[model samples]
Target chain A: MNHFFEDSVFFGVTLSFLSYGLGVLLKKKLKLGILNPLLVSIVITVIVLVVTDMDYEIYYNGAKYISYLLTPATVCLAIPLYEQFEILKKNVAAILAGILSGVLTSLSCILAMVLIFNMNHKQYVSLLPKSITTAIGMGVSEELGGYVAITTAIIIITGVFGNVIGEFVLYIFRIKEPVAKGIALGTASHAIGTAKAMELGEIEGALASLSIILSGIITVGFAPVFAQIH
Target chain B: MKYLRQFGIILFISFLGEIANYAIPLPIPASIYGIIILFLCLELKILPLSSVKETGKFLIEIMPVMFIPAAAGVLNVWGIIKPSVIEYIAVMVISTIAVMAVSGLVTQLVIRLTGHSGHQ
Candidate 1:
């Protein structure tokens, strides 16, 4: 009876794309700002994995290729950064300042959470890279002796929120400029936020992409200092 | 052919990044090297933007597709993370909003002071 599904080799990869297709369909059909396809796909995939009694490791074996693609995707962001080089040259100072503020805010929040919640060493460290892109966040988290799986979960949770409410926050704050919007999205949400930024504007996409990298670098630096404190 | 060439440029840059990963003694990942080198390449005219712009855009546009598997992998560690689920969710939400508000406002203020706040 279960022979058909016993292989589970291609199932993971095939399911990922199929769920992504469903996510796209749902997003188009619902037209909700918060309807992130990645989030949707994960939810659906998780349910399917649970229902099918599939071990996550088996699923991961095939899905890891998609995960590997993140490296090149991170590399691809350079194109947008280059496209908006002029604005970058002009607003370098402001951009740096904004990144600093964002980095500080993220760190402080994590610090407070760790202190308040009394989280364990690994838990706190995993959450440290919660706001950056997955590839960099995974590296930083692992360097801090945290689990990559936990770090990714925290990161996606952060990104999903930022991708959804990021624009609403800007609208409320009256942050009309592309640079400001992009910085906030990228700094707070990483790649998913950058995707939202891309939808917002070219300038936003460029700045958000830049912000993703900068915040990542900042988190890498911050992780060491954070380790010393703990 | 155009897409292939553009993708080739990105892959080639990523390859260099792998080398820089060993050459440089930073915790920074190879992908970061890829980004930095590519930026320098585009800026220095060593690699023309027109060559890779479309392909780069396409890859980045669909980046969410790549993140799905990682996010789903959360299932593997959910048992360990389940205890602090509430705390984790709270921290993520609060921190995201705080970071966004602080950075966005600070950037807007700084750019405004520079007298160039026309959304650019």
Candidate 2:
């Protein structure tokens, strides 16, 4: 059993796929709030790794191939952004200004939380880019000497949390504007929240796509300056 | 052959982005460079939208699966996360809501100011 997991080629796919399969099954079977396939898969993977006493490097060795797909996936965002170009052109100024504030708010909120909770600097840096996609968020965290794993965790949590609660917040605040809803979804949760925005309508989906990239670009540019702040 | 070619286009752009990262003076990442190049390609009519549209949608639809490994890596940092789990959740939830409110309000305000209806 121990040596079985040591093989990168076999371990990563076998375990990851098995866990993900189970996750999908559970999601279909159970209608619980915590039935997130990603979360379920991660929890199972962690448990299996811990139980087998297998090294993450071995697991990652195979899993990194899947992770590499993110590059093309990131590029794929251009299609929807392209589809939404007309709307983007019409509201370019509003979208840009909203994104500019969205990026700053995300950063400042992290800082404010750190100050209020007196959290450590390392964690602060790690959480700075939670509002964007993992690829850019990981880069921002690594550049600032933050722990990448921590950043990844915070990011997944933020995305899932926002995805779950976004509508309630919108309703409570009476935020009826589609542009507002789309911007909120993309800026706060990146792609996952954009997935929710898609269900709202085409314009919302397009706006969400536009906002994710805009927010990512803004975060990339804003991160260094933020890193230097504290 | 078709999807392969489309994927190839994106991969080639990614390759150029990797090269640009080192060559360019700016701090932008290769992925961003790729995104920018691709966006411009679409905008300038250099890369027709139809070629990549299918492959792009196919890739984006399954993007969630790619995040598994990255999120699974969190096991390594469990020690840090365990101590501040509550604080972490509090901060994340609060900040997420705050960012959403701020961005949404700002977008609506900006749209209204620009004489756009934003009625929907």
Who wins the lDDT comparison?
Answer: 1
Model 1 C-alpha lDDT per residue in residues A48-115, reported as the tens digit of each score = 88998877777777787777777787888888888888888889888999998999899888988888
lDDT of 1 by residue, B18-93 (tens): 9998898877778888989999999999988898888888888777777777777777778978989998988898
Pairs of colliding residues, candidate 1: none
**Which candidate should be chosen as best, given DockQ against the real structure?**
1
Cα shift from native, residue A27, model 1 (Å): 2.6
| Cα lDDT of model 2 by residue, A114-223, tens digit | 88899878888998999898777888899888988888889987876776677777787766778778888899998778766765766776778778878988888888
- Candidate 1 local Cα displacement, residue B37, angstroms: 1.0
lDDT of 2: 0.79
TM-score of chain B of each: 0.93, 0.86
Q: What is the TM-score of each candidate against the true structure?
A: 0.92, 0.84
On a 0 to 1 TM-score scale, where does candidate 1 land against the true structure?
A: 0.92
Show where candidate 1 strays beyond 4 Å: A1-10, B118-120
